[model samples]
Target: MTDQVMAAIDGSQFSTAVCDAAAWASLALAAPLTFLHVVDNHPQTAEADLSGNIGLGSREHLLEELASLDEKRARLAQEQGRLMLEAAKSRAIENGVAEPGIRQRNGELVETLAELEDDIRLLVIGKRGEAAHKASEHLGSNLERVVRSLHRPILVVPEAFETPRQVLIAFDGSKTTRKGVEMVAKSPLFRGISCHVVMVGAEVADMRSQLDWALMTLNDAGFEAHGEIRAGEVEESLRSYQQEHAIDLLVMGAYGHSRIRHLLVGSTTTGMLRKATVPVLLLR
Candidate 1:
């Protein structure tokens, strides 16, 4: 089965952008789109706080009543989740995604993604949650956890949607970045976009050679590719280069620890995500 693009939405302002990005990815890959809204049931919420309000004699009865209440709340929550999913699906359709799938599950986001990892080709989530927005770090730690769990391309969408005509690739001669380069070259995701391959480090001959090799590979793959070398902090060099060239998307490697980091998204760091102004694409 062809993989689908999964967009995680929380019904915040970010949902619209997530849908837009997911729709773009879905169309780009000619794959189906699935909007997932997780009904996160916190452990603390399962039991009602009746101990303080009820006498000991009524405590047992209250516990039974609380159990019933919990059931009712769960039902209501699922209904609300369905509504959120419907709205998300409508947004995806309006954004040009045809017949997008809607999934409302009761579980942790990372665990849920893991369960469906085999079916998802790309994962799209907001760059920031509704409660925070500054740099990529504030996009939420949960967002990082979600990315770390999936061995697929993840599109971290910003506040709005923009067609990515140009992509700036941050390469550091790492194996992960090499994998990212290969993914971009082979995937239909970036077929018609322009790519600027950059290596940020000391202006050593080896650095230049690596950049040239990456550019050659991209060019050989039929991309309008260019190569450059920058000397400075990796993130700052990428920021300046992207700004000067007006890059629409930033494609790099993973973030996080353990096998998840190495297998997906690659050497991309949280600091880089925190500083980015454009959408970031991370491939493992």
Candidate 2:
């Protein structure tokens, strides 16, 4: 079966943008769009232990009431998820996705997406979820986890939607990043978009050669491609270039560095996702 463009929607400010961005991706890939809403059941999973209480009768009554309340809360949460999915489907339809599908699952977001990964061609999610709606400086707690757990490409969108005109690829000469460049070259998602491949490091001959290869590959694939080198921190240099060129979409490899290395310093992927005002497409 052809994989679908799956979008993770929730009751957050980013819902509209997520829908819009998913619609764009769905059209770009010529794939069906599916909106997935996960109802986290962690809060209501554990039943209270009312044993060893002074009054058995009172304990039983209290347990019954607690169980009832838990049932009610779970029902309410499911209903809310259903409503959110329906609304997202409507918005996606309005945004030019014909007959978008909606799914409501009861599980953790990362686990649910992993379960559905085989059916997803591209995964679109918000930069911040409902829990982090007001935390502008922080990325959604689930974002990194989802990226780490899933093998599929993920598109992390900001809270606002804007049709991407230019795309920036942060190249690091890693295997993952080279694959990302090739994907961009071949995928219809970035067709006809201006592409920039940049390396942030010392201006060495090898760095220049790598940038030239990226440019050549993109140009051969029929993209209006550009290449450059910057000297500074990876995240800051990329951000500055993106702003200067009005880049609406950013692409890079997801956690290409080793886990130990990142633990010692930090993950460039996390930093970019946290700071990028535009949508970021992370290829793993």
Candidate 3:
């Protein structure tokens, strides 16, 4: 991946938070920042075949009128996306991103992101988009698709953002999570921050061994790392620890062979993403 932090911005309430989170990440990682806005390909704005065989009558005129309306709608959508990108760029600049790049494309969000996945080091996006704002219980329509489609780490920010002082890793000792731990240890983004690796289950030999390994790995990297084995439901235990310790950032491995098989397959990962008030950094 290239050394750049890309923030997906829509004109929703979470746009400001996305920019702030992206700016924070860019500064922490010392990478260039880019703002991306996609004019979603909605069926209503799709091109229509007005030239199709229409009995020469008012129906032909109506089809032409519909096609013209679709064109106008598409133009309006493009303009709106452009304005949103400009606004997000301004916000990122104010938040200390020097000169953020801007990309406005007309396509599906997931497809656009997949096309740029190889060049993105990190992606920052809102937890919910304009379409899902009315449904607080749901994630953005494209969030899960983007996560599953792209391999880069994603920082999903809530409607508000603040620099994280404490990070909680929902460690499971799986290969994916182990890689995540290693990434956290080596990346400059989490430098000088308190890290807590938590595994939820009965305190057994295997669990203890993995926990110790994670601690050692992090400690070796010069982090103030702490390990814990909490017993209870996965989501509840993690959420409780996060609230009790005032954790500002949550880290997890996505689409692993562990419990996070598929993000939306009724797993703890889905619950955490749905209810998490803090920003979650998902590593794959």
**Each candidate structure's count of clashing pairs:** 9, 0, 0
Least accurate 10 contiguous residues by lDDT in model 3: 257-266
Off by over 4 Å in 3: 45-56, 257-266
Per-residue alpha-carbon lDDT of model 3 for 1-284, expressed as tens digits?
A: 37799999987898899999999999999999999999865658444555557655666777778788877888898899888888888888888889889998889999999999888999999998888855666887689888778889999999899999999999999988999899999999999899999999999999999999999999999999988999999999999999999999999987644465444423777889989899999888
Tell me how far the alpha carbon of residue 102 in candidate 2 is from the true structure, in angstroms, after superposition: 1.0
TM-score of each: 0.87, 0.93, 0.92
Rank all candidate structures by their TM-score, best first, as comma-separated numbers: 2, 3, 1
Q: Model 2 over residues 133-239: C-alpha lDDT tens digits?
A: 57667877788678778989999999898989899999988888888899999999998799999999999999998999999999999999999999999889999
Predicted structure 1: clash tally? 9
CA RMSD of all predictions: 3.3, 2.3, 3.0
- The CA lDDT at 170 in model 2 is 92
Rank by lDDT (best first): 3, 2, 1
Which run of 10 residues does model 2 get worst, by summed lDDT?
257-266
The C-alpha stretches of model 1 lying farther than 4 A from their native spots are 43-54, 61-69, 130-137, 256-268
TM-score of model 3 (CA atoms): 0.92
